[model samples]
Target chain A: MEDLDKELVRRARLGDKDAFAAIYEHNLPRIYRFIYFKTANRATAEEITQEVFLAALRAIPRYHDEGFLVSSWLYEIARNKVIDFYRSKKSDISIDEELEERPELTSTDFVKTMETKIEADKLKNLLKKLPEDYQNIILLRFVEDLSNEEVAHSLGKSLGAVRVLQHRALKALRKLVE
Target chain B: MTKERIHNLFDKAKEIKPSEGFLSRTRARLYEEPLDHPRSQFFFESLHFGATQAGIYATAACAAAFIIYMSSSISVNEKQSVAMKRTEQIEDYKIDVTLKDARYYKEVAPNVFVVVSK
Candidate 1:
Protein backbone atom coordinates (compact mmCIF):
# COMPACT_ATOMS: atom_id res chain seq x y z
CA MET A 1 0.00 0.00 0.00
CA GLU A 2 2.87 2.35 0.81
CA ASP A 3 4.51 1.48 -2.49
CA LEU A 4 1.26 2.13 -4.34
CA ASP A 5 0.86 5.49 -2.64
CA LYS A 6 4.48 6.36 -3.41
CA GLU A 7 3.92 5.47 -7.04
CA LEU A 8 0.79 7.57 -7.10
CA VAL A 9 2.63 10.46 -5.51
CA ARG A 10 5.46 10.13 -8.05
CA ARG A 11 2.99 10.24 -10.91
CA ALA A 12 1.00 13.04 -9.31
CA ARG A 13 4.17 15.05 -8.99
CA LEU A 14 4.45 14.83 -12.75
CA GLY A 15 1.03 16.48 -13.15
CA ASP A 16 -0.85 13.25 -13.56
CA LYS A 17 -4.38 14.29 -12.72
CA ASP A 18 -5.60 10.74 -12.43
CA ALA A 19 -2.87 9.94 -9.97
CA PHE A 20 -3.84 12.93 -7.85
CA ALA A 21 -7.48 11.97 -8.09
CA ALA A 22 -6.61 8.53 -6.83
CA ILE A 23 -4.73 10.00 -3.92
CA TYR A 24 -7.69 12.24 -3.15
CA GLU A 25 -10.08 9.32 -3.23
CA HIS A 26 -7.95 7.19 -0.95
CA ASN A 27 -7.29 9.88 1.66
CA LEU A 28 -10.61 11.70 1.57
CA PRO A 29 -12.36 9.67 4.26
CA ARG A 30 -9.58 9.87 6.82
CA ILE A 31 -9.06 13.56 6.16
CA TYR A 32 -12.79 14.15 6.35
CA ARG A 33 -13.11 12.33 9.64
CA PHE A 34 -10.14 14.25 10.99
CA ILE A 35 -11.61 17.59 9.99
CA TYR A 36 -15.03 16.51 11.14
CA PHE A 37 -13.71 15.75 14.61
CA LYS A 38 -11.94 19.06 14.72
CA THR A 39 -14.80 21.26 13.53
CA ALA A 40 -17.72 19.11 14.73
CA ASN A 41 -19.68 20.45 11.80
CA ARG A 42 -20.49 18.41 8.74
CA ALA A 43 -20.50 21.33 6.33
CA THR A 44 -17.28 22.77 7.71
CA ALA A 45 -15.59 19.39 7.68
CA GLU A 46 -16.61 18.83 4.08
CA GLU A 47 -15.40 22.28 3.11
CA ILE A 48 -12.07 21.86 4.87
CA THR A 49 -11.62 18.41 3.42
CA GLN A 50 -12.04 19.85 -0.06
CA GLU A 51 -9.56 22.59 0.69
CA VAL A 52 -7.05 20.07 2.04
CA PHE A 53 -7.15 18.06 -1.17
CA LEU A 54 -6.81 21.19 -3.30
CA ALA A 55 -3.84 22.34 -1.27
CA ALA A 56 -2.31 18.90 -1.51
CA LEU A 57 -2.79 18.86 -5.27
CA ARG A 58 -1.05 22.19 -5.64
CA ALA A 59 1.80 21.27 -3.29
CA ILE A 60 2.25 17.72 -4.61
CA PRO A 61 5.24 18.80 -6.66
CA ARG A 62 7.03 19.98 -3.55
CA TYR A 63 6.32 16.92 -1.40
CA HIS A 64 9.39 14.72 -0.90
CA ASP A 65 9.18 11.09 0.13
CA GLU A 66 10.51 10.75 3.67
CA GLY A 67 9.61 7.13 4.41
CA PHE A 68 6.19 8.09 5.76
CA LEU A 69 2.76 7.44 4.36
CA VAL A 70 1.04 10.04 2.23
CA SER A 71 -1.77 9.97 4.78
CA SER A 72 0.63 11.48 7.28
CA TRP A 73 1.18 14.38 4.91
CA LEU A 74 -2.56 14.70 4.35
CA TYR A 75 -3.09 14.70 8.09
CA GLU A 76 -0.60 17.51 8.48
CA ILE A 77 -2.40 19.54 5.83
CA ALA A 78 -5.76 18.80 7.39
CA ARG A 79 -4.45 19.86 10.77
CA ASN A 80 -3.21 23.18 9.42
CA LYS A 81 -6.38 23.84 7.48
CA VAL A 82 -8.36 23.28 10.66
CA ILE A 83 -6.15 25.73 12.48
CA ASP A 84 -6.60 28.27 9.68
CA PHE A 85 -10.31 27.70 9.76
CA TYR A 86 -10.51 28.44 13.45
CA ARG A 87 -8.22 31.42 13.09
CA SER A 88 -10.29 32.94 10.31
CA LYS A 89 -13.50 32.48 12.25
CA LYS A 90 -11.92 34.34 15.17
CA SER A 91 -14.31 32.57 17.49
CA ASP A 92 -13.10 31.46 20.88
CA ILE A 93 -15.64 28.66 20.89
CA SER A 94 -14.03 25.26 21.37
CA ILE A 95 -15.09 22.11 19.56
CA ASP A 96 -16.93 20.78 22.60
CA GLU A 97 -18.75 24.09 22.91
CA GLU A 98 -19.56 23.98 19.24
CA LEU A 99 -20.82 20.43 19.65
CA GLU A 100 -23.05 21.55 22.52
CA GLU A 101 -24.42 24.49 20.54
CA ARG A 102 -25.19 22.26 17.58
CA PRO A 103 -28.92 21.94 16.95
CA GLU A 104 -30.56 18.54 17.01
CA LEU A 105 -31.72 17.69 13.52
CA THR A 106 -34.94 15.79 12.68
CA SER A 107 -35.03 13.88 9.42
CA THR A 108 -36.25 10.67 7.85
CA ASP A 109 -32.63 9.59 7.86
CA PHE A 110 -32.45 10.39 11.57
CA VAL A 111 -31.42 6.93 12.73
CA LYS A 112 -28.16 6.75 10.81
CA THR A 113 -27.39 10.46 11.16
CA MET A 114 -28.05 10.46 14.88
CA GLU A 115 -26.02 7.33 15.41
CA THR A 116 -23.05 8.88 13.64
CA LYS A 117 -23.59 12.21 15.39
CA ILE A 118 -23.92 10.69 18.86
CA GLU A 119 -20.76 8.67 18.34
CA ALA A 120 -18.86 11.73 17.07
CA ASP A 121 -20.23 13.82 19.94
CA LYS A 122 -19.23 11.29 22.54
CA LEU A 123 -15.78 10.93 21.09
CA LYS A 124 -15.33 14.67 20.75
CA ASN A 125 -16.52 15.49 24.24
CA LEU A 126 -14.14 12.94 25.66
CA LEU A 127 -11.15 13.90 23.50
CA LYS A 128 -11.79 17.63 23.18
CA LYS A 129 -11.17 18.36 26.86
CA LEU A 130 -7.59 17.19 26.50
CA PRO A 131 -4.72 19.39 25.34
CA GLU A 132 -4.49 20.01 21.63
CA ASP A 133 -1.40 17.84 21.18
CA TYR A 134 -2.88 15.12 23.33
CA GLN A 135 -6.07 15.13 21.29
CA ASN A 136 -4.09 14.96 18.07
CA ILE A 137 -1.97 12.10 19.33
CA ILE A 138 -5.02 10.18 20.47
CA LEU A 139 -6.97 10.75 17.30
CA LEU A 140 -4.17 9.96 14.90
CA ARG A 141 -2.61 7.17 16.89
CA PHE A 142 -5.68 5.38 18.12
CA VAL A 143 -8.73 6.55 16.17
CA GLU A 144 -6.99 6.65 12.81
CA ASP A 145 -4.72 3.69 13.58
CA LEU A 146 -1.69 5.49 12.14
CA SER A 147 1.73 4.10 13.04
CA ASN A 148 3.83 5.93 15.60
CA GLU A 149 6.18 7.07 12.87
CA GLU A 150 3.29 8.38 10.80
CA VAL A 151 1.84 10.08 13.84
CA ALA A 152 5.22 11.59 14.56
CA HIS A 153 5.48 12.87 11.02
CA SER A 154 1.93 14.23 11.07
CA LEU A 155 2.46 16.02 14.38
CA GLY A 156 6.02 17.09 13.55
CA LYS A 157 7.39 15.33 16.60
CA SER A 158 9.94 12.66 17.34
CA LEU A 159 8.83 9.06 17.77
CA GLY A 160 9.76 9.22 21.45
CA ALA A 161 7.78 12.40 21.88
CA VAL A 162 4.78 10.83 20.20
CA ARG A 163 5.01 7.85 22.52
CA VAL A 164 5.15 10.10 25.56
CA LEU A 165 2.29 12.19 24.25
CA GLN A 166 0.26 9.07 23.55
CA HIS A 167 0.85 7.76 27.02
CA ARG A 168 -0.05 11.09 28.62
CA ALA A 169 -3.06 11.55 26.37
CA LEU A 170 -4.45 8.14 27.18
CA LYS A 171 -3.88 8.70 30.86
CA ALA A 172 -5.65 12.04 30.66
CA LEU A 173 -8.52 10.53 28.68
CA ARG A 174 -8.79 7.74 31.18
CA LYS A 175 -9.18 10.25 33.99
CA LEU A 176 -11.87 12.00 32.02
CA VAL A 177 -13.62 8.72 31.42
CA GLU A 178 -13.43 7.66 35.08
CA MET B 1 -14.94 3.65 30.92
CA THR B 2 -11.97 1.44 30.32
CA LYS B 3 -9.58 1.88 27.41
CA GLU B 4 -11.66 -0.75 25.66
CA ARG B 5 -14.73 1.46 25.85
CA ILE B 6 -12.80 4.43 24.53
CA HIS B 7 -11.55 2.33 21.65
CA ASN B 8 -15.10 1.21 20.98
CA LEU B 9 -16.28 4.79 20.87
CA PHE B 10 -13.54 5.67 18.42
CA ASP B 11 -14.47 2.73 16.26
CA LYS B 12 -18.03 3.98 16.12
CA ALA B 13 -16.87 7.49 15.32
CA LYS B 14 -15.09 6.09 12.30
CA GLU B 15 -18.50 5.49 10.81
CA ILE B 16 -18.88 9.21 10.37
CA LYS B 17 -18.02 10.21 6.80
CA PRO B 18 -18.97 12.74 4.18
CA SER B 19 -22.01 11.98 2.13
CA GLU B 20 -21.52 10.39 -1.29
CA GLY B 21 -22.90 13.50 -2.98
CA PHE B 22 -20.40 15.67 -1.17
CA LEU B 23 -17.56 13.37 -2.14
CA SER B 24 -18.51 13.37 -5.83
CA ARG B 25 -19.06 17.11 -5.89
CA THR B 26 -15.71 17.79 -4.27
CA ARG B 27 -13.92 15.46 -6.66
CA ALA B 28 -15.51 17.20 -9.64
CA ARG B 29 -14.61 20.61 -8.37
CA LEU B 30 -11.02 19.54 -7.65
CA TYR B 31 -10.68 18.17 -11.16
CA GLU B 32 -12.20 21.30 -12.64
CA GLU B 33 -9.68 23.48 -10.85
CA PRO B 34 -6.26 23.73 -12.42
CA LEU B 35 -3.22 22.63 -10.42
CA ASP B 36 -1.13 25.54 -9.23
CA HIS B 37 2.61 25.64 -9.97
CA PRO B 38 4.09 28.22 -7.60
CA ARG B 39 5.64 30.94 -9.76
CA SER B 40 8.02 31.83 -6.97
CA GLN B 41 9.67 28.42 -7.18
CA PHE B 42 10.12 28.80 -10.92
CA PHE B 43 11.55 32.29 -10.53
CA PHE B 44 14.02 31.19 -7.87
CA GLU B 45 15.15 28.17 -9.91
CA SER B 46 15.68 30.32 -12.95
CA LEU B 47 17.56 32.87 -10.90
CA HIS B 48 19.77 30.19 -9.38
CA PHE B 49 20.56 28.64 -12.75
CA GLY B 50 21.32 32.03 -14.27
CA ALA B 51 23.61 32.93 -11.42
CA THR B 52 25.53 29.64 -11.69
CA GLN B 53 26.03 30.05 -15.44
CA ALA B 54 27.11 33.65 -14.97
CA GLY B 55 29.61 32.58 -12.32
CA ILE B 56 31.12 29.98 -14.65
CA TYR B 57 31.44 32.46 -17.47
CA ALA B 58 32.97 35.12 -15.21
CA THR B 59 35.57 32.67 -13.91
CA ALA B 60 36.49 31.63 -17.45
CA ALA B 61 36.78 35.26 -18.53
CA CYS B 62 39.04 36.09 -15.58
CA ALA B 63 41.32 33.09 -16.31
CA ALA B 64 41.60 34.02 -19.99
CA ALA B 65 42.40 37.64 -19.13
CA PHE B 66 45.11 36.56 -16.66
CA ILE B 67 46.68 34.22 -19.25
CA ILE B 68 46.68 36.95 -21.93
CA TYR B 69 48.17 39.54 -19.54
CA MET B 70 50.96 37.21 -18.40
CA SER B 71 51.88 36.15 -21.97
CA SER B 72 51.90 39.73 -23.23
CA SER B 73 53.98 41.01 -20.29
CA ILE B 74 56.55 38.19 -20.72
CA SER B 75 56.96 39.03 -24.46
CA VAL B 76 57.32 42.74 -23.70
CA ASN B 77 60.03 42.00 -21.10
CA GLU B 78 61.85 39.73 -23.59
CA LYS B 79 61.78 42.50 -26.26
CA GLN B 80 63.09 45.11 -23.75
CA SER B 81 65.97 42.81 -22.68
CA VAL B 82 66.89 42.14 -26.34
CA ALA B 83 66.92 45.89 -27.09
CA MET B 84 69.11 46.55 -24.02
CA LYS B 85 71.57 43.84 -25.12
CA ARG B 86 71.75 45.30 -28.64
CA THR B 87 72.43 48.77 -27.20
CA GLU B 88 75.23 47.36 -24.99
CA GLN B 89 76.79 45.57 -27.99
CA ILE B 90 76.71 48.83 -30.01
CA GLU B 91 78.44 50.67 -27.16
CA ASP B 92 81.15 47.95 -26.94
CA TYR B 93 81.74 48.16 -30.73
CA LYS B 94 82.17 51.92 -30.48
CA ILE B 95 84.67 51.48 -27.59
CA ASP B 96 86.64 48.86 -29.63
CA VAL B 97 86.86 51.19 -32.67
CA THR B 98 88.06 54.09 -30.52
CA LEU B 99 90.75 51.88 -28.94
CA LYS B 100 91.96 50.68 -32.37
CA ASP B 101 92.07 54.23 -33.78
CA ALA B 102 93.87 55.47 -30.67
CA ARG B 103 96.51 52.72 -31.04
CA TYR B 104 97.06 53.39 -34.78
CA TYR B 105 97.37 57.16 -34.24
CA LYS B 106 99.72 56.73 -31.30
CA GLU B 107 102.04 54.62 -33.43
CA VAL B 108 101.81 56.45 -36.82
CA ALA B 109 101.27 60.12 -35.85
CA PRO B 110 101.69 61.16 -32.18
CA ASN B 111 100.47 64.76 -32.89
CA VAL B 112 97.40 63.52 -34.73
CA PHE B 113 96.94 61.02 -31.88
CA VAL B 114 96.83 63.91 -29.36
CA VAL B 115 94.09 65.62 -31.42
CA VAL B 116 92.33 62.33 -31.91
CA SER B 117 92.54 61.66 -28.14
CA LYS B 118 91.28 65.15 -27.42
Candidate 2:
Protein backbone atom coordinates (compact mmCIF):
# COMPACT_ATOMS: atom_id res chain seq x y z
CA MET A 1 0.00 0.00 0.00
CA GLU A 2 2.85 2.38 0.82
CA ASP A 3 4.53 1.53 -2.46
CA LEU A 4 1.31 2.21 -4.33
CA ASP A 5 0.87 5.50 -2.49
CA LYS A 6 4.44 6.47 -3.36
CA GLU A 7 3.87 5.73 -7.03
CA LEU A 8 0.61 7.65 -7.05
CA VAL A 9 2.20 10.58 -5.27
CA ARG A 10 5.09 10.62 -7.76
CA ARG A 11 2.69 10.72 -10.65
CA ALA A 12 0.50 13.27 -8.95
CA ARG A 13 3.52 15.49 -8.39
CA LEU A 14 4.04 15.48 -12.12
CA GLY A 15 0.50 16.81 -12.68
CA ASP A 16 -1.17 13.46 -13.28
CA LYS A 17 -4.83 14.02 -12.54
CA ASP A 18 -5.67 10.34 -12.63
CA ALA A 19 -2.98 9.52 -10.13
CA PHE A 20 -4.21 12.17 -7.76
CA ALA A 21 -7.75 10.96 -8.21
CA ALA A 22 -6.63 7.51 -7.18
CA ILE A 23 -5.10 8.93 -4.05
CA TYR A 24 -8.20 10.98 -3.33
CA GLU A 25 -10.43 7.99 -3.79
CA HIS A 26 -8.36 5.87 -1.48
CA ASN A 27 -8.21 8.43 1.32
CA LEU A 28 -11.52 10.25 1.00
CA PRO A 29 -13.62 7.98 3.19
CA ARG A 30 -11.18 8.04 6.05
CA ILE A 31 -10.59 11.75 5.76
CA TYR A 32 -14.29 12.44 5.57
CA ARG A 33 -14.93 10.13 8.46
CA PHE A 34 -12.32 11.92 10.51
CA ILE A 35 -13.80 15.29 9.78
CA TYR A 36 -17.35 14.09 10.28
CA PHE A 37 -16.53 12.83 13.72
CA LYS A 38 -14.86 16.08 14.59
CA THR A 39 -17.61 18.41 13.41
CA ALA A 40 -20.58 16.06 13.89
CA ASN A 41 -22.24 17.62 10.86
CA ARG A 42 -22.48 16.13 7.42
CA ALA A 43 -22.34 19.36 5.42
CA THR A 44 -19.40 20.76 7.34
CA ALA A 45 -17.57 17.49 7.10
CA GLU A 46 -18.15 17.32 3.35
CA GLU A 47 -17.03 20.88 2.86
CA ILE A 48 -13.91 20.51 4.97
CA THR A 49 -13.08 17.21 3.35
CA GLN A 50 -13.21 18.83 -0.08
CA GLU A 51 -11.10 21.71 1.14
CA VAL A 52 -8.52 19.27 2.48
CA PHE A 53 -8.26 17.54 -0.90
CA LEU A 54 -8.11 20.82 -2.74
CA ALA A 55 -5.31 21.97 -0.52
CA ALA A 56 -3.56 18.69 -1.09
CA LEU A 57 -3.93 19.09 -4.85
CA ARG A 58 -2.41 22.52 -4.77
CA ALA A 59 0.45 21.49 -2.51
CA ILE A 60 1.34 18.11 -4.03
CA PRO A 61 3.66 19.69 -6.56
CA ARG A 62 5.95 20.83 -3.78
CA TYR A 63 5.57 17.72 -1.66
CA HIS A 64 8.68 15.66 -1.02
CA ASP A 65 8.47 12.31 0.70
CA GLU A 66 9.65 12.52 4.31
CA GLY A 67 9.37 8.79 5.14
CA PHE A 68 5.70 8.90 6.17
CA LEU A 69 2.55 7.67 4.51
CA VAL A 70 0.58 9.97 2.25
CA SER A 71 -2.45 9.28 4.38
CA SER A 72 -0.60 10.69 7.37
CA TRP A 73 0.02 13.90 5.50
CA LEU A 74 -3.64 14.05 4.48
CA TYR A 75 -4.71 13.55 8.07
CA GLU A 76 -2.49 16.41 9.15
CA ILE A 77 -4.12 18.62 6.59
CA ALA A 78 -7.57 17.50 7.61
CA ARG A 79 -6.78 18.21 11.24
CA ASN A 80 -5.63 21.72 10.41
CA LYS A 81 -8.63 22.37 8.23
CA VAL A 82 -10.95 21.37 11.05
CA ILE A 83 -9.14 23.71 13.38
CA ASP A 84 -9.37 26.49 10.86
CA PHE A 85 -13.04 25.83 10.39
CA TYR A 86 -13.69 26.35 14.08
CA ARG A 87 -11.40 29.34 14.25
CA SER A 88 -13.17 31.02 11.39
CA LYS A 89 -16.55 30.51 12.96
CA LYS A 90 -15.37 32.16 16.19
CA SER A 91 -18.73 31.39 17.74
CA ASP A 92 -19.41 29.70 21.04
CA ILE A 93 -21.38 26.96 19.37
CA SER A 94 -20.40 23.82 21.22
CA ILE A 95 -20.31 20.47 19.46
CA ASP A 96 -23.40 19.41 21.37
CA GLU A 97 -25.23 22.53 20.28
CA GLU A 98 -24.25 21.99 16.68
CA LEU A 99 -25.26 18.36 16.85
CA GLU A 100 -28.64 19.28 18.33
CA GLU A 101 -29.22 21.94 15.68
CA ARG A 102 -28.47 19.52 12.87
CA PRO A 103 -29.76 16.31 14.32
CA GLU A 104 -31.48 15.09 11.17
CA LEU A 105 -28.50 15.88 8.93
CA THR A 106 -25.94 13.89 10.88
CA SER A 107 -26.88 10.62 9.22
CA THR A 108 -24.75 10.08 6.11
CA ASP A 109 -25.35 7.35 3.56
CA PHE A 110 -22.68 5.21 5.22
CA VAL A 111 -24.82 5.08 8.34
CA LYS A 112 -28.16 4.70 6.62
CA THR A 113 -29.01 1.56 8.53
CA MET A 114 -30.81 2.59 11.69
CA GLU A 115 -28.85 0.43 14.12
CA THR A 116 -25.42 1.49 12.81
CA LYS A 117 -26.42 5.16 12.64
CA ILE A 118 -27.35 5.20 16.31
CA GLU A 119 -24.18 3.41 17.32
CA ALA A 120 -21.98 5.74 15.25
CA ASP A 121 -23.69 8.85 16.55
CA LYS A 122 -23.35 7.68 20.15
CA LEU A 123 -19.67 7.02 19.65
CA LYS A 124 -19.17 10.36 17.91
CA ASN A 125 -20.83 12.30 20.74
CA LEU A 126 -18.70 10.52 23.33
CA LEU A 127 -15.61 11.31 21.24
CA LYS A 128 -16.54 14.98 21.00
CA LYS A 129 -16.60 15.31 24.79
CA LEU A 130 -12.96 14.29 25.17
CA PRO A 131 -10.14 16.81 24.96
CA GLU A 132 -9.01 17.60 21.44
CA ASP A 133 -5.78 15.61 21.58
CA TYR A 134 -7.47 12.69 23.20
CA GLN A 135 -10.25 12.75 20.61
CA ASN A 136 -7.70 12.86 17.81
CA ILE A 137 -5.67 10.09 19.35
CA ILE A 138 -8.70 7.86 19.77
CA LEU A 139 -10.12 8.56 16.33
CA LEU A 140 -6.87 8.08 14.46
CA ARG A 141 -5.53 5.24 16.57
CA PHE A 142 -8.59 3.06 16.93
CA VAL A 143 -11.35 4.16 14.56
CA GLU A 144 -8.98 4.67 11.66
CA ASP A 145 -6.66 1.84 12.73
CA LEU A 146 -3.55 3.82 11.90
CA SER A 147 -0.24 2.51 13.17
CA ASN A 148 1.36 4.14 16.21
CA GLU A 149 4.11 5.64 14.07
CA GLU A 150 1.59 7.01 11.62
CA VAL A 151 -0.47 8.55 14.40
CA ALA A 152 2.65 10.07 15.91
CA HIS A 153 3.67 11.63 12.64
CA SER A 154 0.16 12.86 11.91
CA LEU A 155 -0.19 14.46 15.33
CA GLY A 156 3.41 15.76 15.49
CA LYS A 157 3.96 13.83 18.71
CA SER A 158 6.56 11.33 19.78
CA LEU A 159 5.92 7.59 19.68
CA GLY A 160 6.04 7.42 23.47
CA ALA A 161 3.74 10.40 23.73
CA VAL A 162 1.23 8.78 21.40
CA ARG A 163 1.30 5.63 23.47
CA VAL A 164 0.74 7.53 26.71
CA LEU A 165 -1.99 9.64 25.15
CA GLN A 166 -3.67 6.59 23.74
CA HIS A 167 -3.81 5.03 27.17
CA ARG A 168 -5.18 8.18 28.76
CA ALA A 169 -7.68 8.69 25.97
CA LEU A 170 -9.01 5.17 26.34
CA LYS A 171 -9.34 5.65 30.06
CA ALA A 172 -11.27 8.87 29.56
CA LEU A 173 -13.51 7.22 26.97
CA ARG A 174 -14.28 4.46 29.41
CA LYS A 175 -15.35 7.01 31.97
CA LEU A 176 -17.62 8.69 29.42
CA VAL A 177 -19.08 5.39 28.43
CA GLU A 178 -19.75 4.46 32.04
CA MET B 1 -18.62 -0.18 29.60
CA THR B 2 -15.74 -2.55 29.48
CA LYS B 3 -12.68 -1.97 27.30
CA GLU B 4 -13.91 -4.67 24.97
CA ARG B 5 -17.22 -2.90 24.59
CA ILE B 6 -15.50 0.39 23.80
CA HIS B 7 -13.33 -1.33 21.25
CA ASN B 8 -16.39 -2.85 19.71
CA LEU B 9 -18.02 0.54 19.48
CA PHE B 10 -14.97 1.96 17.68
CA ASP B 11 -15.09 -0.94 15.26
CA LYS B 12 -18.68 0.05 14.44
CA ALA B 13 -17.73 3.69 13.96
CA LYS B 14 -15.21 2.56 11.41
CA GLU B 15 -18.16 1.83 9.17
CA ILE B 16 -19.04 5.53 9.14
CA LYS B 17 -18.11 7.20 5.86
CA PRO B 18 -19.05 10.02 3.56
CA SER B 19 -21.91 9.63 1.18
CA GLU B 20 -21.18 8.38 -2.32
CA GLY B 21 -22.76 11.47 -3.78
CA PHE B 22 -20.45 13.66 -1.79
CA LEU B 23 -17.43 11.62 -2.80
CA SER B 24 -18.24 11.72 -6.52
CA ARG B 25 -19.20 15.36 -6.43
CA THR B 26 -15.99 16.29 -4.66
CA ARG B 27 -13.96 14.24 -7.08
CA ALA B 28 -15.62 15.85 -10.06
CA ARG B 29 -15.08 19.31 -8.66
CA LEU B 30 -11.44 18.59 -7.89
CA TYR B 31 -10.65 17.16 -11.33
CA GLU B 32 -12.54 19.94 -13.06
CA GLU B 33 -10.17 22.51 -11.60
CA PRO B 34 -7.05 20.78 -12.99
CA LEU B 35 -3.67 19.87 -11.51
CA ASP B 36 -0.65 22.15 -11.62
CA HIS B 37 1.08 22.25 -15.00
CA PRO B 38 4.24 20.19 -15.32
CA ARG B 39 5.86 23.00 -17.25
CA SER B 40 5.40 25.37 -14.33
CA GLN B 41 7.01 22.90 -11.95
CA PHE B 42 9.97 22.53 -14.28
CA PHE B 43 10.26 26.26 -14.66
CA PHE B 44 10.41 26.85 -10.92
CA GLU B 45 12.93 24.02 -10.49
CA SER B 46 15.07 25.47 -13.25
CA LEU B 47 14.87 28.89 -11.65
CA HIS B 48 16.14 27.43 -8.36
CA PHE B 49 18.96 25.61 -10.12
CA GLY B 50 19.88 28.77 -11.98
CA ALA B 51 20.07 30.71 -8.74
CA THR B 52 22.37 28.14 -7.15
CA GLN B 53 24.63 28.03 -10.20
CA ALA B 54 24.84 31.79 -10.27
CA GLY B 55 25.82 31.88 -6.62
CA ILE B 56 28.55 29.28 -7.14
CA TYR B 57 29.98 31.11 -10.14
CA ALA B 58 29.93 34.41 -8.28
CA THR B 59 31.81 32.90 -5.34
CA ALA B 60 34.42 31.30 -7.60
CA ALA B 61 34.94 34.56 -9.43
CA CYS B 62 35.41 36.44 -6.18
CA ALA B 63 37.93 33.85 -4.96
CA ALA B 64 39.86 34.05 -8.20
CA ALA B 65 39.99 37.84 -8.04
CA PHE B 66 41.24 37.77 -4.46
CA ILE B 67 43.98 35.24 -5.29
CA ILE B 68 45.15 37.25 -8.28
CA TYR B 69 45.17 40.47 -6.27
CA MET B 70 47.15 38.82 -3.45
CA SER B 71 49.73 37.24 -5.82
CA SER B 72 50.26 40.47 -7.77
CA SER B 73 50.75 42.49 -4.55
CA ILE B 74 53.28 39.96 -3.26
CA SER B 75 55.28 40.09 -6.51
CA VAL B 76 55.26 43.91 -6.47
CA ASN B 77 56.58 43.89 -2.88
CA GLU B 78 59.36 41.42 -3.85
CA LYS B 79 60.33 43.60 -6.82
CA GLN B 80 60.52 46.71 -4.63
CA SER B 81 62.71 44.95 -2.07
CA VAL B 82 65.11 43.76 -4.81
CA ALA B 83 65.33 47.32 -6.20
CA MET B 84 66.10 48.70 -2.73
CA LYS B 85 68.85 46.13 -2.22
CA ARG B 86 70.46 47.00 -5.58
CA THR B 87 70.50 50.70 -4.68
CA GLU B 88 72.19 49.93 -1.32
CA GLN B 89 74.83 47.78 -3.08
CA ILE B 90 75.56 50.56 -5.58
CA GLU B 91 76.01 53.08 -2.76
CA ASP B 92 78.39 50.76 -0.88
CA TYR B 93 80.54 50.23 -4.04
CA LYS B 94 80.84 54.04 -4.50
CA ILE B 95 81.92 54.45 -0.86
CA ASP B 96 84.62 51.71 -1.27
CA VAL B 97 86.00 53.33 -4.47
CA THR B 98 86.22 56.81 -2.80
CA LEU B 99 88.13 55.37 0.21
CA LYS B 100 90.64 53.56 -2.04
CA ASP B 101 91.31 56.80 -4.05
CA ALA B 102 91.90 58.71 -0.83
CA ARG B 103 94.43 56.10 0.35
CA TYR B 104 96.33 56.17 -2.96
CA TYR B 105 96.47 60.00 -2.95
CA LYS B 106 97.78 60.07 0.60
CA GLU B 107 100.53 57.56 -0.21
CA VAL B 108 101.57 59.35 -3.46
CA ALA B 109 101.61 62.76 -1.74
CA PRO B 110 104.10 61.54 0.90
CA ASN B 111 106.38 60.08 -1.83
CA VAL B 112 106.36 63.40 -3.80
CA PHE B 113 107.14 65.36 -0.63
CA VAL B 114 110.21 63.16 -0.03
CA VAL B 115 111.55 63.86 -3.59
CA VAL B 116 111.09 67.61 -3.21
CA SER B 117 112.87 67.59 0.14
CA LYS B 118 115.86 65.77 -1.36
Across residues A1-178, which tens digit of lDDT does each residue of candidate 2 receive?
8899998997787778899999999999999989888885667788899999999999998887988889999999999999999989844333333343334455563245456657778888898789999999999999999999999999999999999999999999999888
DockQ of each: 0.26, 0.30
Residue lDDT tens for model 2, B12-79: 88887776677788999988876567687757766776798999999999999999999999999999
Best by TM-score: 2
Off by over 4 Å in 2: A90-112, B38-118
Q: What is the C-alpha lDDT of each candidate?
A: 0.80, 0.82
Docking class of 2: acceptable
Kindly report the interface RMSD of candidate 1, rounded to 1 decimal. Answer: 4.0
In model 2, residue pairs whose N, Cα or C atoms come closer than 3 Å (at least 3 residues apart or on different chains), thus clashing, are none
What is the Cα-based TM-score of model 1? 0.66
Residue-level lDDT tens digits of model 1 in B10-56: 88888876777778888899889776544575466557767999999
Task: Give lDDT tens digits, candidate 1, residues A1-178.
Answer: 9899998987787667889889999989889998888875677787789999999988988998998889999999999999899889844343333223333434545667677678778888787788889989888887789999899999999999999999999899888877
